[model samples]
Target: MPEGPETHALADRLATLLVDERLTHVRFIDPGLQRRRALLERQRVLAVEARGKALLTAVAGGWTLYAHSHLFGFWRFVDDQDALPDGAPPRLVLATVRGVAALYAAPSISLWRTDELGAQPYLAKLGPDVLDPAVDARALLAHMRTPRFARRTLAVLLLDQGFAAGMGNYLRSEVLFQAKLSPHRALEDLATNERRRLANALLDVPRRAYRAKHDDALPPGKDYLARTRAQFGFEVFERKGDPCPRGDGRIVEDRLAGRRLYWCPGCQQ
Candidate 1:
C-alpha cells in the first residue's frame, strides 16, 4: 500500500504540474461516480494537497477530486509522446498543460463539494496525518493518552486511521522497529519519551523519504541494520530468520493483530 510519504510526494509533484492550469478534460471510469458529469468536467485545478494517504485536487469552480490509493493505485505523469505505462489503464485521467496525470487502479475516487469535504464520513474519522507539516506532536500525545486508546496494542493502533492516519503495514512495522517498541505493547505501557519517539519516527520517516527522492540520494540507513544486513536497505520488517542487526540474537517473528510482526527480541524489549 502507498503510505503517507508516497502520497505526499505525489501531491507535491501534481501541485507543481497542475496548479493554475485549466483542466482541459476530466474522465471518470469508476461506476461509483459516473453520474457526476458537471462536477467532473472542465474545471481549473486550483491546488493539489494531501491528507494522509489521500490526495485532493481542488477545482476552480467548487468541487474537489478525492482519491485514495488504498493498496494498488498509483499515479503516472506522462507527456503526450509517452504511452500510458503498462498495467491497467487509469480509472481517471486529467489532461493538463504539463501532460496527462493519470490515476490508475484507485479503488476510491469521487467528486465532492469543497465545503462539505471535511464533513465526509471518511475524512471526519481520520486522526492527525503524520506527513502533515503542521501536526502538533504534543497534542497528539495528549490524545493518545485518553482512555479510548490506552488499552489498544501499539501495532493495531498505528493502523487505525482514527488513531494516526497514513500508517500502513510496512510503516507500522518499521516505526515500531525504529522506536524499539514491541508490537504487543499496550499504549498505556509506553513512557512519555517512548511516545514522543514513536511519533517523531512516524513524521521523520516520511519527510526523509520525500527528501531522499528530491535529492536523489539514498535515505539515511537505520543504525543497527547498516552494519549486519547483506541486502543493505531494510532494517527489520522482512528480515525474519536472518541475524538481528543488533547482533543480540537472530530476528524473530510473531503475529500481532493478524499481521506479521518482526523484531530483534533481545534489542526491542
Candidate 2:
C-alpha cells in the first residue's frame, strides 16, 4: 500500500506539474466514470493536496479529483510524451496542457464537488492525518484516552484511520515495536508515558520515511531501532528472521491483527 509518505511525495510531485496548468483534456477511461465526462473535460487544476493516503486535486471547475491507493494504487507524472514511470499497475490517467500526464494506476479514483468534499462519507470518517502539521498530538492523545478507545489494541487503533490518519501496516507495526508496546496491549493498558512515546514515534517515522529512501546507506548488521534507525537503517518490520539488531534475539515474526508484525520480543517488550 502507498502509505502517507508515499502519497505525500506523489502530491508534492504532482502539485508541481499540474498546479496552474489548464487541462487540455480529461479522459475517464474507467467505465464507471464515463458518464461524468462533461464535468471532467477542460477543467483547470488549482492545487493538489494529500490527506492521509488519499490525493485531492482541486479543479477550477469547482470539483475535486479524489483518489486513494488503498493498497496498490499510485500516481506518476510524465512530461512530453514520456513513458509512465515504472512502479505499480495504473488504473487511471489524467493528461494536462503542458503535454504532461498524471497517471493513476490500480487505485480507486473518483470525482466530487469541491463543496461536497467535506461531506463525503469517507473524508468525514478519516482520523487526523499524522503528517498533517495541524494535527495536535496532545489533542489526539486525549481523544484516545476516552473510554470508548481504551480497550482497543494500539496496533489495531493505529491502523484505524479514524484513530490517527497516515498510518498503514508498516507504520502501525513500526510504531508499536518502537514504543515497546505489544500489539495485543490495549490503549488503557499502556502507561501514559508509553502512549506519548507511541504518538511521538508515529509523528517522527513518517517524516523520516518521506525524506529518506531505503537503500544501502542504512547501517549494516544492526537490529536495534532507535530514532537513528532510519540513519542506521531499520529496527524491525521488513528484516524478518534476520539477526536482531539489538543483539537480544533474532527477529521474530508473528501475525497480529491479521497482518505480519515483526519485532525483537526481547528488545521491544
User: Relative to the unseen true structure, what is the C-alpha lDDT of residue 139 in candidate 2, on a scale of 0 to 100?
Assistant: 64
- Report, for every candidate in turn, its global Cα lDDT versus the true structure: 0.75, 0.72
Q: Where does candidate 2 stray beyond 4 Å?
A: 81-91, 102-105, 213-232
TM-score of each: 0.85, 0.83
Query: Which regions of candidate 1 deviate over 4 angstroms?
Result: 31-35, 85-89, 216-233
**Which TM-score value belongs to model 2?**
0.83
Q: How large an RMSD does model 2 have?
A: 6.0
Query: Residues 67-124, candidate 2, lDDT per residue (tens digit)?
Result: 8877655455666545766664346666676555545556667889999999876788
Q: At residue 157, give the lDDT of candidate 1.
A: 94
Clash pairs, candidate 2, are 90-105, 91-105, 91-106, 219-232, 222-245, 223-245, 224-245, 224-246
Considering every candidate listed, which one attains the maximal TM-score? Answer: 1
